[model samples]
Target: MTEDASPRALITGGSRGIGRALAAAFAADGYDLVLVARNEERLEAVARELECGYGVDVTTVSADLTDPDALEEVYERATAGGAVDVLVNNAAVAVYGPVAETDLEAERDQVRLNVAAPVELTKRFLPAMLERDSGHVVTVASTAGMRPGPFLAGYHASKAYLISFSEGLTEELRGTGVDATVVCPGPVLTGIHERSGRGSRWLERRFMRSPDAVAADSYEGIRAGKAVVVPGLRFRLLPWVSRLLPRPLSRRLARLIIDRGDPLESDR
Candidate 1:
């Protein structure tokens, strides 16, 4: 399709990491873009990069999606230009310390960004997609959602909520041309861990997939109308393994993997 006639994709957190990669992927696939992020400079940089590189139209919205008013503004701006044929809810935050040690305010913000933002955005944008009878919703969840994670309890739980919400929404849109695909990626070499003040460099190097690889898998899975997209071979097996193991054993394994250091280190 020509650029003017191409579909448009609105990707949250589009200024960096998986979201940025997805923006490039969609642009290359002939889609115009609405890139949303909190940093205007970064958003503009990404928009210019995509437009210059792929010769596709690009719009940038700078807003903190955790704020209700900011999120509404994003919705208005996104729809103001044109219909968004693909909605990629890729924005999220996480708190990685023990629940008691983590700041409650920070954890609340994490839930707001990771769970509430996507849920509300999906609810608002889905009607237009259903009316058009053609749209795609891709939510970037995590393998952390598949099972209980001790050290990162709040983050994992928030992602679990997103995964469940996307799965149910996908089934609800069965006959409609609109579709929802939740992507569950394991560790990724992104600034998220650094920002969260958690994650070991050693563990990240061992298990993390590249952002580009994750984005490519996510884009292809959404195109194929898959309900769940796990980006790598090891991550793809997580849900199955979680399901097979007894709940207590699974939780223990999750704790071991997530803690990263001696549990006593937090007490020191």
Candidate 2:
């Protein structure tokens, strides 16, 4: 594609982790980018890196997605340039620990960022895509959405909403030349877990997939018009196995594996 004809992708949470990786993947594929994130410094840095390395146009909008007004500003900036051909809803927050112990405000923030943000952004951008009869919507959900999560209750529930929303949108857009895809990745080696005070280095090293791999797989799946993209063989098998097991058994297993203290805790 020529410079002016190249497709543009608008990615939320594009400053770090899977979002940053997705920006790189799209840049490498000759797509210009509009990166939205809370950290202005980080967003500018990433924008420079992608432009310098891939020779693709890059735009950055710094805003906290959890805030409705700030999110609207991001939407305005994203569409000001032109209609985005691809919208990647990757911004999310996780509040870890038992429901009773976790702060309700934090949980609410998680829901706002994880659930509402994507829905609002999708609603705003999808119309233009449908009008043009061409576009892709990619939501970054999680494997935790497949079943109940005891400790990270709110986060899991929010992700479940995203999974359902993405699938429904995909079906709705069937013949509109627009595609919607949800990427469910098991434990990724991102700062999200650490920042949320959930999981451990040992578990992450043992089970987590790299952000780059997850982004690459998600991008490829979206391009192919897949409704769901679950990275890693283990994770891809999780939903099926969870469905085969009894609900109570599945919940018990999840609690034992995820809610319990870290494996290295005993040693420490």
Candidate 3:
């Protein structure tokens, strides 16, 4: 779709945080919106706010993306007959604590939401985009994807798969008139911490970027067809520095950054 085209954007997890910010940004840019999330009430509120603020069409689909059937329905609801022009795969789950102690089902759900859903949704929408020869796919991966994370193993792995998938898709769509951008954001001030049972105001205040800033950069980068969008300069440096350091040293550094609580004391 060209600049003049009135594109439609589908954003998963659009009820809050970066997804919600992106929805508002796109609406202001004159795009019709399909906002997806598990919370129907919040989705409706966001939809109402966007429509009222930007005077654009907005639709909300409430479905658990971890479920394959629900994900299929979400894809159909958002992109029926090739109407969608931009896809933001932002839905994710974060399960903290040790891998052995963590709930296996929760870890599996993270994979289902963060990895499988995005791939499946892309598979469903890619053909239409190829046929039309125009569209953008933005996957909200994370800097955690650049290396293995000790405390957030499952979450990191899921984002790593997204990063690799998006990178590969960018290569395949080289001449297909479709573009994919993967956003690797570092710590951001969002409800994810609370949702994952890792809420810490002090930690967030010290280390996270504002959700608004991350959303703005992501929207601009995706619209400009950039392949990999790393928002902050600090995070942009992390991947390179991690590559330079030895694996063991890099892992220790990651643990220092991502691990919360008193380091001198045991987690218990």
lDDT per residue as tens, model 1, 111-226: 99999999899988999899889898899999889899887899899989999999999899999989999999888766676666664546556776778988888888888999
lDDT of 2 by residue, 58-87 (tens): 999988888999878988888887779999
Candidate 3 lDDT over residue span 177-268, tens digit each: 89999999987777575567755445545777777889888878887899999997767897798689999998887687667542121110
- Which ranking of candidates, highest lDDT first? 2, 1, 3
Q: What TM-score, over all chains together, does every model reach?
A: 0.93, 0.94, 0.92
Cα RMSD (Å) per model? 4.0, 3.3, 4.0
How many residue pairs in model 2 have overlapping backbones? 0
Candidate 1 backbone collisions, by pair? none
Q: Model 1 shows how many backbone clashes?
A: 0
Which ranges of candidate 2 are over 4 A from the true structure? 1-3, 201-204, 260-268
lDDT score of residue 253 within candidate 3: 78
Candidate lDDT scores, in order, read 0.86, 0.87, 0.84
Q: Residue 220, candidate 3: how far off, in angstroms?
A: 1.6
